[model samples]
Target chain A: MRILPRTAESGSYAALAGLAPKRRPSLTPYYFILPYLVFFVLFRLGPSLAGLGIAFTNWQAVGTPRFVGFANFEAMARDPRLGDAFQNTVFFVLLTVPTLIVLSLALALFLNQPRRGRAVGRVVVFMPYVIMSTVVGVLWTWILDKDFGLLNVYLNFFGIANVPWLVSESTAMYGIILTTVWWTVGYDMVLFLAGLQDIPHELYEAARIDGARAWGVFRFVTLPLLAPTTFLVLMLTIINSFQVFDQVYVMTSGGPGTATLTLVQYIYTTSFQFQKFGYGSAVALILFGILVIVAFFQIRGYRRGLKGVE
Target chain B: MSRTISRAAWYVLLAVVVALVLAPALWMLSTSIKPEREIITTQIRWIPQNFTVEHFQAIVQNYPMMQWLFNSLFTATAATLLVLVLDSMAGYAFARMEFRGRGLLFMIVLSMLFVPIQITVVPLFILFSRLGLTDTYWALILPVGANVTGVFLMRQFFLSIPGELEEAARVDGASAFRVFWSVVLPLARPALTAVAIITFLSTWNSFFWPLIVTRSDSVRTLPVGIAQFLSLRAGMVQGQMSIGQSMAGAVFAALPPIIIFVILQRYFIEGISRTGIKG
Candidate 1:
C-alpha cells in the first residue's frame, strides 16, 4: 500500500506548482542525473563515437591500433561476404515486415472485438515474445531439424516430403523468418491493439450508421485512424530486422553456407570471430547508415499520415 | 445468422492461432521431460512417450546450470534495482528540474535510443577489455544499466505528475530529495513496476553482449550457457542425454522471463504500448 501512493495528486500541474522560490541554482539537478549520465557517457556516447573512429582504423584487438583511412570501408565494398550479408539481412526484413504488418493488424482487429477468450488469446500470442531469443532459436532448431525435427516428422506423417527447413540454403532464410514472425508478431499486435483501442468508439458508430459493413468500417474508419501505429510498427520492424542476431546465431551460426548470415552476425564474426575489427566496424557503420535512412523516411511518413488523419 | 457464423469462425481461428503460438514452447517443454531415446524418434509425439525429469537432473548435475541461473538472476535483479534508482532520479531531473543544457542533455539521451547497441559492440568490448572488466558481472550490469530507455520511460511518466503536491511538500519544509523520495516515487509505482519488469526481462534475456564478453563458463548468463550447450550438441558429440539436456537448458533459461511475464502481464503490455516498440 505504501508503494502504491495516491497517483491522483501527482499530475503535471502539481509538478509545475511544486517549484517554490528558485533557491539559487544549486547543483541538485546535476547530482540527480550524474549517476545515469556517467554510465551513459562512458558506455553509450563514448562507444558510439569510438565505433566511428575505430571503423577508420585497423584495430584487431592487438598491438597499438594503426589508422587506415577508409581501407576498412574499401575492403567491405569489395567483400562478397559483406554483400551476401546485406542481401540476406534485407531479404529477412522483406520476408518478415509485410507479413508482420498484415497479420498483426488482422490479429488486433479480431481481438478488438468483444469475443470469448480474447484476453487469453492476447496472452498466448505474446508469450513467445517474452521468452529469450536463445531459447526460441534452440526450440525452433529442434523443431525444424531436417532429419529428426518435429516439423519434418509432422510433414512426413502428412505424406509430404521433408522440407529441409534450416538445412538447405533456400529454405534456411524462410525458417528464420517463420521463427521471427512467431516470436515477434505478438509485439506488433499489442501495439496495434493499443492503437485500435485508441480509436474513439463513436467513429465506428458513425460508420455503422452510414451502413458501412465490416470491410467498409475497417478500410474507411479503422485503417486511416491506425496509420500512425502502422507506420510506427513498420519502422520498428525494419530496425529490429536489420539488427537480428541472436536467433540467427543460435539456429544456424550463419549457416550451412552463410545463407542466413545477417548484417549483425557478419559484424560479429568479422570483428570477434575473425579478428577483423576495423572492417567489422565499417560494416556496422553501413548498417547504421541504412537504419538512419529508413528511420528518416518512416518518421516523415508518420508525420504526413498524422496530418492526413487530422 | 451470418454474424453468428462469423463469430464462431473467429473463435475457431483464435484457438488455432493460440495453439500455433504455444506449440513450439510446448514442444520444448515436452522434449525437456522426454527420455533421449524417444526425443528424436521417427514419429513426432506431442506427449512424451516416457516422461522424465532426468534430463533436467542430468544437465543440472553436469553443467554449471545453477551457476548460470544464479548469475542471470543476480545480474538482472541488480540491474533492475540500479536502473530504478538511477533512472527515476535522472527522469525526475529531466522532467521537473530546471537547469541549463537540460534540453540538450535530454535530447542526447533520447537520440541514443536510435543508435543500435550492436553498432557499439566492438568499441565497448575493447573498452571493457582495456579496463580489465571483461567477463565480470560489471561488464553486463554497467552497460545494460546505461541504456536510456528506462530513463525515457521514467521521464514520460514523471512528466504527468502535477507540481502542486511537491509545492505543498516544500511548503512543509521538505527538501527536494525528500519530496521526490516520499511524494513522487511512491505515486510513480506503476511506472516503476513497468520499468522494473522490462529491465529485468531484458537483462535476463540479453544474449549478444554476454556471448561476446564472457569467455568462461563461470560468468556466463543462462541464455549464453544454453546457446553454448546447443552449439556443443550441434557438433554431434553423440550422447543419448545431449538432446534432452539441451531442451532442458532452454526450458530453464526461458522459465524466469515467462513466469515474470505471466505475473506482470499488465505491466509488460503497458510497457510495450508506451514504448511503441519491442526489440
Candidate 2:
C-alpha cells in the first residue's frame, strides 16, 4: 500500500540540469520498448491482422491459400453446424450472464457484512476458481453424473429422479452452465465486493437516516452507485461467455448432438480439428463482431442509465 | 434476543455457502481415495469406505503426470518472468518518456484486449510450425510474452507513482536504463507482484494454446495432459482412464495451486481486485 502522490513535479530535475532545452531526442525510449514491441508485432498484432486476412482466403493445413472474397462468410450463412453453434452460444450466454450477476452480487453482499466468519466464507467461495478449468470440468462431470453423482444422490433424498446432465442433449448446456457458475461466480463476487467497498459509508447512513429499509437502501443507494461495476462485470461476463470453450471441450465436447456447441469450440474444431483454417478464421471474426456490437449497445445503454441516474 | 438469532442465522448461511462451493472438490478427493467398488455405488458417501492410495499410485506409475506437472510449472514460471521484464521496461517508457508514436503504440496494445485469442491462434500456429518451434516449450512460452494486460497494468502502475526518485537518479547522470533498473523497478514490486501472480495463474491454468501446440507428453502441460489423457474421453492413444484414476490425476494436478492459493490468498484477491477495478 505504498502511497503515490500525483502532484510531484515530474521532470524538474532534467530542467534544473539544463538538459531539457537542447537535449537530442534520445533513442532510449525505443530501446526500452523494442523488445516488447517485437513480441507484440510478431505474436499478437501481426497474428491478429493475419487472422483477419485469413478469413477471406481458402487457407488449410496442407494447401496453398487462395484469396476467396466473402466465400467463407457466404458458407457460414448455410452452415447448419455454425447455426447450432451460434444459437447454443447465445443460449449459454443468456443462461449464464444474469445468473452469474445476481448470484455473485448476492454472495458479495452476504460476505461483505461485518461478521466473524465472513473471511473464511470469502476464501471458501473463491476456492474453486483457483482450480484449473479442465479440472473443474472433470470434477463437475463426476459431481453431475447421472447415476451415482453426489448431486443425484442428494436429489433422490427428496424423491427427485436423477437427471442426465452431460449425456442428455436437453440438459447438456445446463450442465456446462452450472459448472461455469460454480467455477467463475467467485471471481465476479470478488469484483462486486471491491465495488461494494468503494461506495461511501455516509451514503448508506444518509439513506438510513431517511428511514429507508434494507431493500430500499440497496435498490436506491447501493444499486445506482454500483452501476459502473455492474456494467463492467456484465461486459466481461458476456465476452467470456461468448468465448466459453474449455469446460465444453472437456465436459461435453459440444456433444449429445451439438447441444453445447459454442463459438470458440466451433473455431477450435474448424481450424484445428477439421483443418479448415479459413472457415475457422471466418467464424472467429463473427465472434469478434458480436462482441464489438454487444459492447457498443451495452455502453450506449449504460450511458443512458447514467444520464437517468444524474 | 433478535440480534442473537440473526447472528446464528448468519453463520448458518455462511456454512451452507461454503459447503456448496467445496462439495465438488471434496468429492474429487473422496473419490480418488475410495476403492472402485465404493466409487460406483449409489449411496452418498462424504467419507470414503475402505480408503486406498492405489489409484494415486496407478496414475503415477502409468501416466506422465509428473512430467506434465513439471512442464506446466516451468513454462508458466518462464512466461511470468518474460512478461515482467518486457512489460516493465515498455511500461516505463510509456509512462515517463516522451517518445514518437507513444500514444498510438499503447493504443494498439490496448485495443488488442478486445481481440479474442481464438482469432490469432491459427496464424500463430502457422507461424510456429514454419519456425519449427511447434511442440516445444518455446511455443508454449513465447506467445504469452505478447499478453496485453500485464503491459497495461504495469503502465497504469508506473503512471501512479511519483517520478521524483527516477528523475533525481537521472539528474545524477545515471543512464535511463540504469535509472529504470535500479530506481524504478524496486518501487514497482507491488505492481510486479500483481502482474506475476495473474500471469502465472493464467499460464498454469491455460489450456487452449497449449492443447493446440504441444503434441507429446514431454512438453504437454497439466491442463492439456489431464484433459487429453486422464479425462472421461481420454484421447486416442491412452484409451479411457478409470474414474478412480481420473480423480487421482485431478487431485494431483489441483493440489499445488490450491495450496499456493490458500497461502497467498491475500495477494491473489488484491491482484484480482486491482485488475477488475482498473481494467
Candidate 3:
C-alpha cells in the first residue's frame, strides 16, 4: 500500500524540504496552520476539556454550577435508562457490524467481477448512502408502518401477518439495524472493491496455474490480501454503530418503553430535554471513554494484522 | 456457454440488489406524487395513479420547508468553503512545512479524531448560548467547519504531489501563499473537490447539532425541520400526518445530496477508498 512509506523518518524531511526555498527557514507554515488551530481549540479542544469538567459539576443552564464530585457518574450507574441505553447500544453494535462487513464484502466481490452493466449496479448500491440520515429514518419508518408499509404489504402478499416493526419493542431495534445496513453498506463495499483492485493479478495468475478453483482462489488469495481493508472497515463501522442516534431518534424516539434508546439519544434527552447538562456531560464522557477503548483495541488488532501480513 | 450463463445470472442478482436498495427512495417519490387517499391505501402501488403536486405546493406555501431548504444550502455552502480553506492550509503545513513543535501539534490534531465529537456538544451548546450565538446560523456553521478529517485527507493528498512543482515555483520568487495558490491548489483540485462534496453532504445532512442548538424554524436546517415536521404531524390527531407533504419535504431534503452524488460519484467512491488506504 502507499501508506507503507509513511512510517519512515525521511518522508517527513522530504515533505518539508519540498516546501523550502533556497534552504532558508520560513514562518509561512505556521501562518497556514494557525487559522485551523484557532477554531480547533475553541470548538474541539476547549469544549472537550469543558465537557470533562462539567461532568463533575451540577451545572444547569441558568444556575451557577456547584461541584458535585462523581454524583453524575453515580447517577449514570443507578439510572435504569442509562443501563438500557448501554445494553441497546452494545446490541446495536453486535447486530450491525458483523452483518455489515459480510454483506458489503459480498457485494464488493460480486461487483468486482468483470461484467456488463456493473457501473449502474455500483451507482445503485451507493445511492442510498448519500441521502441524509433523517430522511432515511423517516422514509424507513413509513415503509415499516404496519398498515400501509411496503414491507408489510409484501409480507401480506406472501400470506404472512402484519408486523409492527418500529412500534414493537422486539422489532424496533432490528428495523433500525436493517435501515442502517441499507444506508451504509455502499461505503464499505466501495472500500472493499478498492482493496480488491489493489491486489496484484499476478498472484491470481499463479493460483490459476496451480489449478486453484474459484472458491480456493478467493479463500487463499483474496481474503488474505484484503485483511487491512477489512480491519479499516470493521473499526469504522464499529465506532459509528456505537454512536447510533439520528435514525433511532427520528424513527422510534427511543420509544416503545426505551427499547431503542442508544447512549447518544440518552445523552441528548438528559442534556437538552431535561436540562441536566452535568449528567449529560458525564454520559458523554462515558461514551467517549468507551469509544477510545474500542478504538485502542482495534488499532492494536490492526498492528497485529500488519505484523502477520509482514 | 457456461460463462455466458453465469454472466446472465450475475445481471439478475444485481438487478434484485438494485431494486431492494432503491425501493425506499422510489417509494418516497411515489408517495410524494400520490393523492392523499391513494397514499393511505393498503395496496402497494409502485407508480401512483392519481399524481398531484398539491402536497409539494402545500408544504412550500404553508410550512417553512422552503426556509429550511435555503438555510441548509447557505450553511452547507459556507461550511464547505471554510473547511476547504482552513483544512487545506493546515494540511499544507503538516505535509510540507517544518515549524517548531510541528510534529507534536500534528499528533495532537490526529489524536483529536478519536475524541468522539458528540462529547463537545454539551459544552459547545453552553458556550454558544453564552455568546448568544445559539439559534443562529453561526452556531450551525462554525463547529462543523472545524472538522479535522479534512485536514488529514488534504495532508495525505499534498504528500502525494511531488515536491518539485512547489520548489520550482518557490525558486521563481513566488511567495509561499502565491505558490500554493497558483501551483499547488490547482493540482489539488481532486482532493479539494472530495473535501467539498463530503463537507457539503455532511453539513446539509447534519441533524444532531442543529436539532440541539436551533429552536426556531427561521434558522433550522432541512433535516431538523423535516424531523420536527414528522414528529409534529405524528403527534397530532390520529391519521392527521401529512404523508404527501412529509414525503415531499424528504424528497426536497434528499435531492441536493443525491444529485451531487450522481454527478460526482467517482470522487465520492475514490475519496472513501483513499481514506481507507490513508487510515
Clashing residue pairs for model 3: none
- Tell me each candidate's TM-score: 0.93, 0.95, 0.94
lDDT of 2 by residue, B1-279 (tens): 999999999999999999999988999999999998898889878798698999999999989889999999999999999999999988888887766688999999988988999999999999999999999999999999999989888888988888778757755778777888899899999899999999999999999999999999999999998887766741111374778888999999999999999999989888887777653
List ranges where model 3 is wrong by over 4 Å: A1-25, B232-240
Model 2: pairs clashing at backbone N, Cα or C within 3 Å? none
* Between candidates 1 and 2, the lDDT winner: 2
What is the fnat of model 2 with respect to the true interface contacts?
0.62
* Worst 10-residue lDDT window, candidate 3 chain A: A1-10
Instruction: For residues A24-138, write the lDDT of model 2, one tens digit per residue.
Output: 5567788889999999999999999999999999998787999999999999999999999999999999999999999999999999999999999999999888899999888
For candidate 3, give the lDDT of residue B48. 84
Could you tell me the lDDT of residue A174 within candidate 1? 90
CAPRI rating of model 2: medium
Task: List model 1 lDDT by residue over A156-226, tens digit each.
Answer: 98898988888788899998898999999999999999888888999999999999999999888999988
Question: Candidate 1, B168: how far from true, in Å?
Answer: 1.7
Candidates, DockQ: 0.49, 0.54, 0.54
Model 2 global lDDT (CA atoms, 0 to 1): 0.89
Cα deviation at B154, candidate 1, in Å, is 1.1
- lDDT for position B239 in model 3: 39
Each model's chain A TM-score: 0.91, 0.93, 0.91
